[model samples]
Target: MKRSLPYLLLVVPYLLLPAVVQGQSKVRIACVGNSITFGHGLPNRTQNSYPGQLQKLLGDRYEVMNFGVSSKTVIRSVDNAYTTTSAYREALASKPDLVFIKLGTNDSRLPYRLKIDEFIPDYRQLIQSFKSLPTHPRIVLLLPVASFLTDTTRQTEQAISSLIIPRIRQVAFEEKCALIDLHALTIDHPDYFPDKLHPDSLGASVIARRLHEAVTSEEVKGFDFFAAIPQPASISSFYGYDCADFTLAGRACKVVKPRFAANGLPWIWRARFWGHEPQTDIALLDRGFHLVYCDVAELFGNAQAVAAWNTFYRFATKAGLAPKVALEGLSRGGVYSYNWAAENPEKVACIYADAPVLDLKSWPGGKGKGKGSPADWVIFKNDYGLISEEQALAFAGNPMDKVAEIVKGGYPMLHVVGDADDVVPVDENTAPFEQKVKALGGQIQVIHKPGIGHHPHSLPNPAPIVDFILKATKP
Candidate 1:
């Protein structure tokens, strides 16, 4: 089954919030204002509302309340002044410990546009009212989400950005309150706002996730770092950065974010080994590069592997990774990397293969100088759907058969080989590939480790490899 649009990217899970919190018995969170907070266009309002989704992420330790009234405004003179609403009174009486105020899009309307001068005072009054509560809740002002409308129904993105958000920012600064820039978050995805006014469930989920990040990230280091995936993943320390283990498209996946993100969010997509010889990954991460892996074990760079990587690539790029990804393949990983790169050559920035199995016939097929694994050969034959050894030998789908396509991508290739590798000899793998690439006017570099087999994958000092990747990645 193929997924498209909203169904494709939405992997939200209705998870149970943790029951215990450190200081508070149950920290009350008040979600104040508008249709988005109330989840107007969502398929399931109760479950998919921003506040409802936020409750699931924050856990049972926090009580999230929704006091949102559709088409309400902070300006009292507007058509529906939020202060006059019963939800506002109820919110004031709820005694919240934290308040998130999101009320401005409605104010960007025609009738309300004239009375917008009163917005600041009303907004400040609203904040003071919340602060005056017995709990003295910490108020967080949210800039209005970008509106794609320009008609009389709703104001345009320009109106919201120039007329509304700047006022909200001023209110945040004047009141000494924290702020979440929802405009900046939603501006990129107009598709999230189908109606140009209300966000659907997927958009609501995005808001909730961003809220989760802003609200809890500072206090909790390991909180659901990649909630874009279905469930909360285990976030263990990876070189003092966050390495999340999760599943993408039913394949086990791992993503390690850089300590400090560099411009363009450049990333390296590693194949095969998740943790073996991680120097190159770590060095790249140190220089602000995201490291990712999607397990295509049985697929083995076949069409299915290409499809899985296609989804992964879309997911990564949508999440703000660079368009072109660096490929890292170690030993058999070479098969996964090169085969996929061959299929989608333009998607690759560069290829770094270490003692890779360029031709499976050389290793698993054991039809060459290297000692072959009969079991793996059987598995490979089955995966490729080859009926016989003759058919397998006749297979023309290997990376060795993809030199023209890979070189046509116009990206450089780097190979690290052990000259004495008997498992997948350098001559049978990287050497031949390099020769083909060079003959065809392509850039290919090979670093040979003499008297070394395929035991160690990368250099102890990964400077050369790191330098090569950084240079390739640079604009």
Candidate 2:
């Protein structure tokens, strides 16, 4: 392979192996590619590389080998012909039963991309090398991981999209090799490739899981990841991704999927306000968190609401969502988040409240300095079995009342409030709660919008909110 890139890294040999498990004849799987495949810039590369993760996912049934070199291109005449590397030779000598060839990232760069004319032929030749093996290995072509370099250098995304991917698809068709479109799998998740060219450990796990499904013959006739859930009532587009609306225990539930599920399939369960100011939900979807919602509205996050959420939680976790989940509370949704967290503290990953109504007395109850919803107020009273205004006013069962218990759950909290919001004033709702959490030495962050109101629930740039959730749910 040509070594023209200035920062070409040494191939980590431990993640993938040159040998199989002792005393067992496991299927020999060889992962062949460049630095991305070699686990460049990833911590504990030997254990977190795509191949390493694949080895663990496949368990003792297969021996995965990582024969990856940095800056290696499939084009033999290029500055770094992947075929010229020791990894290439060793990969061939390993006599693999299965091969995943993920080349072309390096070839997408400026000077190297000049040799684009040779990609198809060279890639075809590379495929033949493994096809000629005695084991007659099944070859799988991996399109390069998508990059967000935003420039012409460092494996240009435009080059990969325009020059490389089509060629890989063509060669896969001609060679009859399996194709696992890594580019499509990862394009929406630029965050996975922190450096824009190489994926971190979490991103590597996405590739590994996709490969696992292929090897294990796991087939999903219409849907894949959400197949474990009950059949959806319908599937439609929600913010450019698949939205499965299904009935779970007689309640309508929605799950807007990411382009690909992130590692562990972490998710954010929205309590209410399905799509209002949905910037944060959309962003989390791109980062591989499923945006879910269960309609338990009108119940005002009462015991019934919490019970419904408990049922949804059990079903969702059973269907493969992480046991602990991030909770999204928009306005009245705060009640659902806090009430549920109070009931099932161990299940909450974190809480994000936007212009939330932490205290019923402030909003629907109208017992303080904030505009109250008369119609919802009646509904709220009846929902909580409040005999009259007296009962509703004195009800200390609201989210604000449960701050101590919620903080004791050990999940951090994030609040986005509009300082001028009269619909749900921060002073009566979130402010006192924040003060209490701080007084109790609990974790809580508040982002106040100076003049903004409650209409817009999230920030224009949801990065800070997303970052907070990501940090809390880091696996």
Off by over 4 Å in 1: 1-227
Candidate with maximal lDDT: 2
Each prediction's TM-score against the native? 0.54, 0.57
Candidate 2, residue 375: lDDT: 89
What are the per-residue Cα lDDT tens digits for candidate 1 across 47-71? 8998999999988777899999998
Error of 1 at 235 (Å): 1.2
Model 2's number of clashes is 7
Model 2 C-alpha lDDT per residue in residues 408-439, reported as the tens digit of each score: 89999999999999899988988899999989
lDDT of 2: 0.80
User: Which stretches of model 2 miss by more than 4 angstroms?
Assistant: 1-224
